[model samples]
Target: MDEELKKMLVKILENQEEFKAEIRKHTEAITSLDEKIMQRTEALFDGYKINSEKIDELTDKIDDLRFDVNNLGIKTLKSENKILELDRRLAK
Candidate 1:
C-alpha cells in the first residue's frame, strides 16, 4: 500500500511540471501577440493624424476661396453701377 501511494504521488508531480511548461509557452505567445497589436495600433493612429491634418488644410483653403469670391461679387456690382451711370450721361 505504501508503494502504491508513492507511485501516485510521483505521477502527480510529473503532471504538475508539464502543466507549468505549457503555461509558460502560452504566456510567451500572448506576449508576442500583444506586441504586434501595439505596433499596428500605433501605425494606424499615425495615419489617422496625417489624414486629419490634410483635411484641415483643405478646409482652410476652401474658406479662403469663398472669401475671395464674395469680394469679387461686390466689386463686379460696383463696376456695373458705374457703367450704368456713364450710359445715362451719354443719353443726356
Candidate 2:
C-alpha cells in the first residue's frame, strides 16, 4: 500500500510539472502577441498622424487658392471699370 501511494504521488508531481510547463508556454505566447499588437497599434497611429498632416496641408492650400481667386475677382472688376471710363471718354 505504501508503494502504491508513493507511485501515485510521483504521478501527481509529474502532472504538476507538465502543467507548469504549459502555463509557461501560454504566458510566452500571450507576451509575444501583446508585443505584436502594440507594434501594430503604433504603426496605425503613425499613419493617422501622417494623414492628418496631409489633410491640414491640403486645407491650407485650398484657403490660399480661395484668397487668390478673390484677388483676381477684384482685379477683374477694376479693369472693367477702367475700360468703361475709357469708352465714356471716347464718346465725348
Candidate 3:
C-alpha cells in the first residue's frame, strides 16, 4: 500500500476506537442514571406507604373518640331525665 494511504487508514482506525470509547462512556452513564432513578422511585413509594398507614391509624382513633362522645351524650340525656322526674315527684 502507498505510505500516505496507510497513514490515512491508521488515522481512521484510531478515530473509530475513540468514537467507540465515547459511546461506551455515555452508555455507562445512562445506566447509572437509570439505576439512581429507580432507587429514588422506590424510596418515594415507601414514604407514601408509611404516610398512608399513619392516616389509617389516625382515622381509627378519631372513630373511637366519636363513639365515646356519642355514648357520653346518651348518658347525659338519661341523667337529665332522672333529675326532672325526681323534681316532679317532690313537687307533687
Candidate 4:
C-alpha cells in the first residue's frame, strides 16, 4: 500500500477506537442513572406508606370523637328530662 493510504487507514482505526471508548462510557453513565432513579422511586413509595398509616390513625381518632359526641348527646337529653319533671312538680 502507498504511504498515504496507510496513514488514512491508521486514522480510521484510531477514530473507531475513540468512538468505542465513548460508547462504553455513555453506557456506564446510563446504568448509573437507572440505579439512581430506582432508588428515588423506592424512597417515594416508602413516604407514601408512612402517610397512609398516618391517615389511618387520624381516621380512628375521628371515629372515637364521634362516639364521644353521641354519648354526650344522650346524657344531655337525660338531664333536660329531669329538669322538666321538677318544673312540672313545682307547678302542681
* Best of the candidates, lDDT: 2
Q: Which ten residues in a row have the lowest lDDT in candidate 1?
A: 5-14
Each prediction's TM-score versus the true structure: 0.88, 0.82, 0.80, 0.78
Q: What are the C-alpha RMSDs, in order, of all predicted structures?
A: 1.4, 1.8, 2.3, 2.1
**Ranked by TM-score, top first:** 1, 2, 3, 4
lDDT of 2 by residue, 23-67 (tens): 999999999999999999999999999999999999999999999
For residues 1-92, could you state the per-residue lDDT of candidate 1 as single tens digits?
Answer: 99999999999999999999999999999999999999999999999999999999999999999999999999999999999999999999
Model 3, 21-75: lDDT tens digits are: 9999999999999999999999999999999999999999999999999999999
Q: Show model 3 residue runs off by greater than 4 Å.
A: 1-12
**Candidate 2 runs further than 4 Å off:** 1-5
TM-score leader: 1
lDDT of each: 0.99, 1.00, 0.99, 0.99
- Ten consecutive residues with minimal summed lDDT in candidate 2? 1-10
How does candidate 4 fare on TM-score? 0.78
State the TM-score for model 3.
0.80
